[model samples]
Target: MISKKIGLVESIASKSNGLDDIRVKINGEIQRAYNYPKLTGEVNIGDEVVLNTTAVELSLGTGGYHFVISNLNNMESNFTPGGHIMKLRYTPLQVKVDAVEEQESPYHDAIEEFESLENMPVVVGTLHSMLTPFVASYKRNNPSKKLVYIMTDGASLPIYLSKNVDTLKNKKLIDSTITIGNAFGGDYECINIYTALITAKEILKADVVFVSMGPGIAGTGTKYGFTGIEQGPILDAVKKLKGMPVAIPRVSFADQRDRHMGISHHSLTVLNDIVNVEVNIPITTYEDEKLDVVKRQIETKELDKKHHIVYINNKNTEEDLNYFGLSVRSMGRNYQQDKEFFDAASSAAYYLMEVCDDSRRENY
Candidate 1:
C-alpha cells in the first residue's frame, strides 16, 4: 500500500523525446505513468520537475495564482502555456446607506428657534457634564418660555451644577421639561428616558437620553462605561421597553462580526433613521442558547413594552480594551476618526430631540 502524498511535477531539465516513457512512484509503488516528449529523466528524486502547470480560475475566489495538476500527455513540457494562467476571479461588493434625515416640524416655532446658521445639533455628554452650552444653544434660537431640557436623572445634580455656573434653573423650562430614568433598574433604562417622557405627554418630557452601559463609575473622561461588549444587558433592557436604539456607525460596523451567531442582532433605528440606530447587543450568559432569542428580537419585533431589568456583568478584560483601542488607532488616521462617527450620530439624535421639543409644545 502506497501511503505517500503525491507531488505534481512542474518542469524537467532535458527535452528528450519520450512522450510516453514518464514514471512516478509512491512508497516504491507505481502511481502515475505518463510520457513527456520534451522532458528528460536525468534528474535527482527531490529535484524540482517543472511541468506545464495550469491555473484554476473561478468566480467567488480570492484573486491568487494556484497550480493545477492533470493526467495529460506532455503535461510537464508546456511551462510557458500553463505558468501564466490566472486562477481566481473577482466580484464587486456593495454598500447601502440605510439612514435618512428629515426637517423639523413647524410647531417648534412656537416654543423656540434654531441656531442662526448651524443646522447641526450641540453635544451634551451626560447629565453631570456641562449643560450651559447645550441649554444656551437651545435658548439662543428659541424663546425662554418654550425652551427646556427634559430631565432624565431625577436628582438635582444637573440643576445644582447648572446653578453653580450662574445658569439659573428656569422653573418654567423645568416644568415643561420631561423627566425620565428608572430610580430603580427597569427593562429599558434608556427607553424609560423616552417612555417616561411620552407617558407624561408633557411638551418636553425628554429632549435626549445619554445612554451609557453601567456597573462602572459614572464620571466624564475616558473612564465611563458602555464599551462594545457591554451592549448585551443594555439591549436586553431595550427589548423590554418596546423602544429602539440609536447606535453610532463605529458600533454598527463592529456589531456586524457577530451577526451570523445572532449575538450581534438588531439594526434598531430611531427618529426616522436620522438620530439613532441600535445594533448588536452582546449575549449575557450561555450565549449559545440565547442566539435564537436575540435573532427573534432582531427579525421580529414580537416583544412589546415589557422592559427587562438586568444587572450588567461588569467584568471586562482591560487588555482587550487596550488592544481594541490600539487597533482602532492603527487602522484609522486618528482615534477620533473611529469615535467621531459615533459621536456625530449621537449628536444627530440629540438634535432630533431638541427640535421635536419645540413642535411637541405647539401641539400640547
Candidate 2:
C-alpha cells in the first residue's frame, strides 16, 4: 500500500558520500529525489528510477523529498560485513549492522566492562543545529576533552545528511559518532540510545557526550506531535545510566511563531510534562525583558520544581564559534539572527565545564 512511482533522472543536483540529491521527472512532473549510490549505484541522466513518493504525496514537513528505491539502469547490490541485526527491516536495502550490545558483536565485551557513566556530562538538545554550538563551545574551553556525539533516529536516518557532523569531525571538534536505532552510517552503529551512551563512556572514553537527531526535525504544530519529543526519553536514559543530563533549552526571540518565541514549546513541553527525571536546564543571561518570557514560561510550566533551572552567562559563545571558524544557522536564522537559540546551547556547554571542574576538584 506504500505509494511508489517510476521516474526518469532529469539531472543530478549534488553528490556526496554515496548519496545524491537529484531531480527526477515522473509523469511529466519534476520532483526532488535522494539517491543512495551504495544501494542503487551511481544514477545518470535518462535512467529510469523507482521512488518512494508516499511522504512527498502527503506533503509532510521534513519528509518532502522522495527516496530512490532502485535504478532500472543499475541492478547491483553490495553486501558488506556487519552483524545479523537488521535496521529498516522488511524494506529494500535493509542493512545488517554490528550493534555493540549484541551477543555476537566484537564490542560486546565493552558493554560488560561498562558499569556507569561516572557522572559523565551529557548535553541533550532538541535540534541538530544545537550540536555545533554546544560542541564548539565545549571544545573551545576544554581543548583536551574527548567529545562523542550520539545521534538518534528521530530525524534524518543517514548521518551523511549532516554537513555539520562532517565539518566537526574533520576539524576534530568531536572525537567520534554513534548512530542509534534505524539510523545508519556512524563510525559505530548502536541498537539504541542506552548502548550508545555506554559505548561513549566505556569504549570511546568520552569526556563529554552530545546527543541529538540529525538535521530536518519534523513538527506538526501540535502538542506531543513533534519529533523533538524524543528529548524527554533521551534525558531519562542519560539519568537512568547515572550520567549528568544537561538540557539545551531552545530559546529564540527571532522566531516569528509565538509558541517558540522565548523558550520553545518543544523544550518546555519535554521538561514540563514528558521527562520524569530532573535535568539541568541552562538559560543564558539575556536582557531582563527577554529573560522575563523564559522566567514566565518556567513559572507557568513549573519546570523549576521539576528540573534544576541554572542561569549561565554565554556571551562568549560567538567568540567560541568564531574561534572554531564555525557558522551555524537554525530555522534559517544565523547566530546574530538567533542569538538566544545559540546561547542556550552554549550555556549548556558552559554548565558541563562547571560540572567537569567540580568533578576534577573532588578527585584532587
Candidate 3:
C-alpha cells in the first residue's frame, strides 16, 4: 500500500537531467522529496504536488525523502514514447524505453548479428557502492580505455537515483552507461545483461564494462535471499558471452553482522554455488588476519576447484578515489571504516586492468 499527501514545493534543492531533489511542506512540516520530470512535469516553488509518502511513513531508507507523484501546478505530462519496450511493466508508472535489442531500435540488427564479447574484461560487483572505487582503480591505469557501466535491475529501477554514477561521469571515470533489465535513464538501455554486454562491446565500443546494481540493495536475512545474488548470473552471462568475468568479492570487517564479517556470504554463495562458470575471483592482500579468514571461507567451500583466486594488493583505493575527487561509503561505512571492503573491490579492479590489457592485445 502507498501513503500519499498533497504538499507544497518549498524549493528546488537540486536539478539534474531527469531528476529533481526538492523540499516540500507537508502538514506544516518541511521534508525532502524527489521529482521525476518525465513521469510528472517539473515542480517549481509554490507548486502543490502529490507526494508518495509510503517509504517515509514506514521509516525506510529512502534518505527520509518522499516521491512526487504529481505536480498540481504543472499538470502537463513530460513523457515521450521512446519505444514499445516497457519497464515497470503493468505498473501505474510503467515507462517506455528504447531497448537496444528491440526490433524498432536502430541497433537491433547489430544486436542480432552479435558474435561475442571477444574476451572483453567485465567486472561484476555485488553492491552498488563498488562502482566508484572499481572505476577509479581501473581508470587510474587505463585512462584511454573506455569503461562502460552496465547497471542491473537488482536494486533501484531508475538509474537517476545514483549520485555516484553522476559523480563518476562528471570526473570521466566511466565512459558510458547502459541500463539493463528494468533500470532506466542510462545513456543506453537493454532488455537484459546479455544484450547490454553486446551493446557495450559493439555499440558503445567499451574496453571494459562494470556490472552492478544501482542503490538500495534488499536483504531478507536468509541465505540466497539478497539482491546481490544477481552477481552470480551476471558473471555467468559474461563467460557465456565469451567475455572475461572478474568478480569483486564483498569483504568487510566493520560490518557488525556475522554473515558479512570476513568475506560476505553473499559473495561466497555467488562465487561458490550460484555461478557455474569458472571466473576470476580477486581478493585483497591484508597484513592482519582478514586474509586468513577470507581464504578459509573459500577453502571451506572448496572454491579453489571451481574458480581462480587472484591475490591482488590494492591499497591505493582511497588515493584513487581522492584523485578522482569522489568519495564512496557502503552500508554507512567510509573507506577507512571498511578498508577491506573497498580494497577487495580495488583488488578486482587491479586484476581486471591486467586482464583487459591482455584482451586488448589479443582482440584489438
Candidate 4:
C-alpha cells in the first residue's frame, strides 16, 4: 500500500513546531515533501531520505507533497517523555503519548472526576474546511470565549499536516488543541472523543469546542464511503456526554456533483441513518429559491423530525473572513466560488455562540 523512493533534500522550505516542509529531488526532479522531525528526525539540505511517494503517484489528496519516511543521514529519533498510551497503535510509526485520560497524566484525576459537559457548546462539522469560517466568525462574535479544537483521526493522522491549524493557533483564533484517536501533534492528546470532550471543558476550561478531523478528508462516490460520516457518532457522543451538539450542514450550491449540490448526500446519510440522537443543524439565510431547495431536502429526508434546524443570518461571513485574514477553501473552491458551503459554517458558529449564551443566562 506504500510506495517509497530515495530522495535528496534540495532545499528547506520552512519549519514550524514538529513539521518541516522541504523540497527534495527524486528521480531527477525537485518536488515538495514533508518531514516530521519527531518521526524521521530533522532533515537538512543534502540529506538522503526515504520518501513515501504513494499519495502523489496515485494523485490522492495529499496536497501534492510526498512524506519523508526516514532521514538516512540522521537515523536516530529521540523518544518523547511520559504516558503508556500508544497512538497509531501496532504500526511501525506507533507513538506513545501522554493522553489526558491516562493514569499517569496530571489531569487524570480531573478526567476521572468528570461528570457531564454541563451543556458546554460543542460544534461538530464533517469537513476540516469548516474550521476556518466557524472559528473566525465565532471568535469575532465572542472574542472572550475559550475555543478548544479536537482533531479526530477521520483523515490525516498528524495534526501538523494542517497548515490551517497552525495559522489559527498563531492568530490566537484557537485557544488550544486536543488530538484524539490516532491523530497526534497537539497541545494535548486523548484516547478518544469522550476524553477529548472532557479535556476541552474540564481541563482546558473552554467555553466552546470545535470537533473536526485534520486536513485531507477521505471520500468515495458510494453512499457509505466518506470519512465525514464520523460526524454522526461525534454528535451522538456530545449529546451522550450532556454537551449541546450543533451540526454544520454540508450545504453547497456550487458543486457540480448532483449528490453534493443542495445538501451533500453524505450529510443526508449521516443525519438520516447514522446519528441516533437529537442534534441542532444550522443553515445560513439564503434567497427564497435556495432556501426552498434546502427546505425540500429537510422535509423529504425528515431531518426536522430528528434534529433542530435553525436559520442563522451569517451575512458577513466573507467580510468576517477577510477581517480576520483567514483564507479558507473546500474541494479546491474559495469563498466566492463556494459561498453557501462557507456560510453553513459561519451560520453554525453564530448559532452556537447564541445557544451557549442563552444556556448560560438560563442557568444564571
Which lDDT value does model 1 have at 60? 13
Runs in model 1 deviating more than 4 A are 1-124, 153-168, 171-194, 199-364
Native-referenced Cα lDDT, model 3: 0.87
For residues 134-250, write the lDDT of model 3, one tens digit per residue: 888888878998999999999888898899988889888888999988899899988999999999999998988899999888888788999899999998899899988888889
User: What TM-score should be assigned to candidate 2?
Assistant: 0.92
Name the regions of candidate 2 deviating beyond 4 angstroms. 27-31, 57-59, 358-364
Q: List the residue pairs that clash in candidate 3.
A: none
Better of 3 and 4 by lDDT: 4
**Best candidate (score: TM-score):** 4
Residues forming the 10-long window of minimal summed lDDT in candidate 2: 355-364
Clashes of each: 20, 0, 0, 0
TM-score for predicted model 1 compared with the true structure: 0.25
Q: On residues 206-257, what C-alpha lDDT tens digit does candidate 2 reach at each position? A: 9889999998898889988999999999999998988888888889999999
Local accuracy of candidate 4 as per-residue lDDT tens digits, 192-243: 9999999998889999899999897888899999999999999999989998
TM-score of each model, paired residue for residue: 0.25, 0.92, 0.96, 0.97
- The positional error of residue 209 in candidate 1, measured at the CA in angstroms, is 8.3
lDDT of 4 at 239: 89
**Considering TM-score, where higher is better, how would the candidates rank from best to worst?**
4, 3, 2, 1
